[model samples]
Target chain A: MKSLIDFGAVKIYIDCSVKLAERNINHLYPSYVLEDNTVPPDYFVSLKYGGGIRRFVRKQVLFEQDSKSHFKPVPENHAYASFEWGLNYVVSNYAQEFLTIHSGVVANNDKAVIFPAPPGSGKSTLTTYLMGLPGWRLLSDEMALMLPETSYIQPLIKPVCLKNNSIDIAKKWFPDGKFSSIASATAKGDVAHLSPPASSWQQRDRVAKAKAIIFPKYTPNKKMEIYKLDKNQGFMQLAENVINLSLQGERGFNTLTHLIENTEQFEILYSDVNEVKDFIEQDLL
Target chain B: MSKHKISSQQLFDLLADSQNALDLSDSDWVDVIRIFRSESVLARFACQLEESGVITQLPSYATKHLANAKLVAQRQVSSVRFECAEILHIAKNTCEKLYLLKGAAYCLASLPVSKGRTFSDIDLLVTKDVLAQTETSLKLHGWLSEPLSKYDEAYYREWAHEVPPMKHSGRGTVIDLHHNLYLPVSGRAPKVELFLEGAIETDGFHILRPAAMTLHAIIHLMLNDDLKHAFRDLNDLHLMMTEFSKQAFWEDLLDLAHKSGFENELFLACRYCRHFFKTSISTEYLTKLANMQNMNQSEIKLLDRFYALALSPKHYLVKRASANFAELVIITRAHLKKMPIKILLYHTAYKVYRSAVESLLGKAFFEKSNS
Candidate 1:
């Protein structure tokens, strides 16, 4: 079935062939994207796979959009995951309206905290946990979309992709939290999507002002330690996490500099969730 | 699904003059945006609307997409220049001459067609002699390539126009270093010097002259089996013909075609350029091409059956039911025209065998395709 999802600035029309893909999407998305014929989508994506003997032997799913496949095929079980990843590629390439950054975005009291971290730095894991906390909403789990020269980050609310050990940690922490079926043995092992609170989806159209930029790194058996970044160092560090700055050019550069100048930049090393929560409530709020 | 009544002719007309978008309904705009984006020519359409000062008249949603597409393409214009400079910095000592090709050439030469052009990666051309030294210099730097398997490597070394793409390790920018226009195999390669004769240096790098570049664009569109960029390539030809057309250009192109032994391709190029864009070409040249290719009216109609479908956007929203069959025919036709029958047969057999393996074991099991 072809469904059109309205994600604030972008509308994605997705058609899935496999039943698992359809089921995953229905469960993972905040609500059913009823067929809306009047509104044309910003992106048209489809998850398709071959059947017959290959279905049983070596099942794989292809993620296609814009009449081309931007990614390699993954196991059929990873159909929904493929769609998520493919959407990222589409936004970064075609939707230059949004200056996309490789970061996790969350907000409280309409103030957004940007977590710009490399892979395995626990960005998603921390984001997944924070989103489940009271009075906080998830703007995005994978990317922060900010219009050029704007301090406000547009909300692209979706399920956070938790991987490997973080998957179990999230499951243990939010026992009642909704999650999609786990896709095992992926490039990022044991991937699953954890849906944010319903309140987050309720305010999907709301844009949050840039409050602070935090770089999170997971250090086991250690308390939270915060290190402030100087404006120049902060500018370079935040700029490194921007995915489409090159495409955004001068305006994107100015936006990042303006953001770094206004916001406090910190690199926090933490293992205790409570310590991080206290710091956020004390300093950020 | 919405019923779309638009056809390939409609698309061609719109691309020929992008101002046609002004009359399009919202549903039609939807089709145009999706198809043009898929065909890698959305920026061209966006450029036309912006230039005509009619961009604001469109709905906000349509304008938003067009504006974004233009921004991306404008970014590439500068990026291409920077990438070209980086390439020269790395390989300048190893080579005496370098010619910018395709998108790089168009951008560096400041041609009209270069505006709103978007490229996947940078493509630059070096002579056959300096090809090795260029590769060695890039290798000493942080460039690496995923080696093709032995079977594919053997054929590539024998017939391919370029070496495997060398990507910079630190920068992650890809450079497709080319030595020839097509297959470098004896008796098949075109006269390289003929193109060089008209080349002009610009911004410390040489690019093919306007006429030569137009012919090369035709050759690229009409010869390559990959019709994925067919619409973009055809639009490129249209823009080039409109900008570079002159009495001398038509003469130089015909002369180059005959001497290069590609008059048949020249005729096809001319006919299709006229068919798609209604581009102005002299009746004299048309008659010359018809006589040169011995192209009967029926043959032209028959060729149009394939090119018309093959050249249209390959999106499900716009594609006809028989588009795949037309595409297959074009690919087969391209192979037959580009190679000898014996080599073509061998190539087909190898491809069939490889596909069978891929079907059973999955693709990328044996080789990570350079693309």
Candidate 2:
């Protein structure tokens, strides 16, 4: 039960003994090229049921890096989530080559629109909406991998984590979109994962130059409003939202400045998905 | 001495000769990167490779990691400078000569060991007579003492060489203040004055001279409790040995060790450095130190096994079977050397009890224990 998943910039070898892990791998990483397990990977991760007798009795699955326990254990049913998080953890910490951002991204014609926001800011929900649009494609739901040297945002196509009320909204909006079984009473309060369309997965390796940097805020019953942002302020905001900004240090600062200078920056306040979509189509281009 | 493991030797060779790194496979590069990152020597490796201009010859993927590491290291150097400045400001009014030790000393001295190596806490040494005043000065400057149990506090106050670590209330930088080189409870206590005799002053602060500094680094490595960061410390020794390998430096180092009654520690350091990193120590002084220390070949062979395994990088990706066992032996020996049999018994009992209570109570106790 070992599989090598090549995620363009990084590759991981996952060893799991559970069906949930396999299902998630198939559903989320549809375009990942499978390789022989013997091929050395950047990280050798294991998602398995173990954590002494108590954990075993409770049917918990722990994520391990290089056979050593890492992070905390989750229930066996959430093995996929643990594996996903473990991969994200390794990338955020070890992917020093990229300035990892906490953002959702959508691309059109290889031009990326990065939506950097804090939690509960409708980042993923907006990304899901943009991804559903005819001409737009999902680049990432979280973790915008910005290459410092190229100043290009690379795509990492994994399941978009839908949380709380958004999960229902996503299901209602995209009836055909694949959704994982609802993980109830989770840390993020009833989380579900939405698998991006197959076309996005197929283009996962496509790296795109950032065209727009949008910080989105969701407000109920509010009209869609877009505000232009100062380049220096946008740089500060991106730096603050990055996961490994300090790891890249000055180079990261320079890369971010370049990204801000080249890209159109905006702060979008929108409640309706259709109105936001119209604004992006009409004004963002 | 036990021969350095092939992988460890290969790592050193690649570090010493970046040309060798260019020949490595992607898989080998990954292992090297993981090991270097694990031991906090990625920056050191990147510095050497980039200096040699071989990093440009490496695959783009491999070079990216190196470039990123170098960037991170550059920022760390800035942080170290900032921390040092703050400490110097705190000790500005104090009359006691503030001597930077370990990583801080290396940075202050602009030694090769400082390049790309991770800086932890600020270590400052003062004369024993001025230790209390130094502590008070640090506290007055916003360094808060880390709370420890009564027994632990007493252990540090009476037996340890340094005060309990203090954290800056504002910046959260930890600082370890020492009045001596070795613990009083450790059978051998080197005279701090002997070390200060060869001190080098820069700006308002001081660092040990090359010979004394190298000796201190070796002694510090020998007295450590675990295999954690042993490779990094060994690399420090190797860098020091390589940089200050003058005949006069070695003679002065041996003389200082002899004067301080740490000849055995020096002997062990040299032997292990030679065995592990293939550090270039002249045979004349090497043989001389070995003779002066006077340990049998069999004893050296036995200790060599543990030191070799312990000094090698212990990254999970390439962890050796003997690593954990070697670390256990070294930790036990270090504990024995750090405390007398009476205190050791009580300390062991208390630790076991605390662990039991922590395990029984689970998360709450775990948080409390860590806090």
Candidate 3:
């Protein structure tokens, strides 16, 4: 089946076996598919989270298919609203131009901030908080797809995951903000996704040239601190943050070199989101 | 010119059924070899299949060659854990605690089969003050110390980041216990405590999480400067990316690399993964990070070429003489740096002698067969 979603100037066709349901949103066209086997009936869902969120799973299969394939279907009405959220991932990622980055992306009019952090660093929480700012757009909470040739970011514009206290913090910060179903006690701590801002969905394919690379750390009760990194050191730091520099080989290396040469780099350590926001807006902006 | 009609799907199927189909007269080993381009990738695939319980189905001859590959992969996997376990056991026995690095911790925590990556030696990190004790404990376990020339041993003990290699009697495993991640000579190395503080416990083993392991792999690849058979090393990175993606373990991986002082390696790994495995990482993040890393246009092109050549499964079977030459040069450089000049010269001479002997024996055998 074919389903078309308008992502700003680009209309993407999500062709899969799944049934599509169109919402008022510009980019999201959620869909789900059920599997039919001779033995018994089984259900699988494919979701398009925006860029490339397509994935298939059998409800009963786990760990058995690890060696054979990467896709695993979780219980529906869980994690994602429907399988369409996951299907979006597959279609978007299949495109050759976009390289999927494993990080949180938040952007304002002038620049986007990409936070590359290990677990427990509170990057997702920080990303959620940052997108709550008045003018900034939430590019993606999970991945940041950047074009290698142009260094331009295509908007994933998915839901932002906020964990534990961050969920409450987000609710308090933006009472009007929407959220999906809460998924508690996950591997990454208790998780809930903040709804994408209406404006972000409106300009889903808008590409942003990153202006700053921030390595964020959530230190409990620590005063907010931002340290500027030198070009050489920053280059190394950014290189380490990349997902597949070696696979891209020469193209990856050159792209990374160019990215480092052009952007400002810093390490941000903070406990207070409000304080971090002020620093980002007043000093960096 | 006729276009080649080999299908990847067909090759994959043939590889899957090579053992049962071995009786077919048309099923030649050359065709099997041609389907797989890189020995390393074939080796990795064979090892993975073997680990997954399909080894018995492979042709016996193919299995024998793959056994060496499996051994290498296993050794790499085991070296990490074995060294970490040995060190930890020693430290616990002696009331001194130590921290495990990268692969050692990862294998211990999650993947039992990861012990397949061939490691020449086990690597351990201990406090500088406890180096003597660690060495003594290792020796007590029947590990024979390789005689490093006096000056080199002194440098290793006093000024270098790690100790000389030691071999175990029972398993013939080698160990390279270290006090630091990078050479102290680098002037700006992160403190060992950074890794120690982040060590996680899983399945009764304390190991580096995904992040630390990714950083460790990157640091090892970047600092060695020995790209000999580096195509294999690239394969290892690809394997890690593919396996890790199954768990959706990207964020943790990136974070750990950043924390461990190898952020560049993480980006490079992600970029390489995208280029080779068709992994689902974001391009925006890759380019943004690449730009942040200062990878320019020309460097990007080179990386892509290297990735395409190194990672393609098609390259594993059809041998390229130039790649072999490049690998030889790299190996020679790495060996020469580590060995004494006289020893290096002697080894070179011995290699030549061995090659001459093999060539003479082959010629005689061929003549006999013809007669």
Per-candidate TM-score, chain A: 0.95, 0.93, 0.73
- Tens digit per residue, CA lDDT, model 2, B279-369: 8877787789878986689978878898878887787655689789988887888788778899889888998888776455432334311
User: Who wins the DockQ comparison?
Assistant: 1
Interface RMSD of 2: 5.7
Give per-model TM-scores: 0.93, 0.90, 0.41
Give the TM-score (vs. native) of candidate 3: 0.41
Q: Compared with the true structure, what per-residue lDDT tens digits does model 1 show for residues A127-151?
A: 8878888889899988999867878
lDDT of 2 by residue, A130-232 (tens): 8987878888888889988555888877788888899889988889888877666766777788888877877778888888889999999999888898877
Residue pair clashes in candidate 2: none
If the candidates were sorted by their TM-score against the true structure, best first, what order would they fall in?
A: 1, 2, 3
List, residue by residue over B1-371, the lDDT tens digit for candidate 1. 67667777888898787677788888788778888877878887888888887787898778888888889889878878887887788888888878888888999888888888888767778888898888888888877776777767777677788888778787777787888777765355687888777689887788898777877777778888889888778878878888888888888988888888778778987778888888887778888888987667897788899888887777776788998999898889878777788888888999999888777766544533211
CAPRI class assigned to model 1: acceptable
List candidate 3 stretches off by more than 4 Å: A1-285, B1-44, B50-88, B94-96, B102-106, B110-115, B150-155, B169-171, B202-205, B246-249, B256-261, B303-319, B324-371
Tens-digit lDDT track of model 3 for A1-285? 434434332233333332222221212222211111111111112232211112332121111110112344333223343333343444243322345466787888948878877767878787887777789888777666667755567776555667778788888877877665554454445556666667777667677887777888999989998899998888777777666454455566677666677778889899987887787788776
For TM-score, the strongest prediction is 1
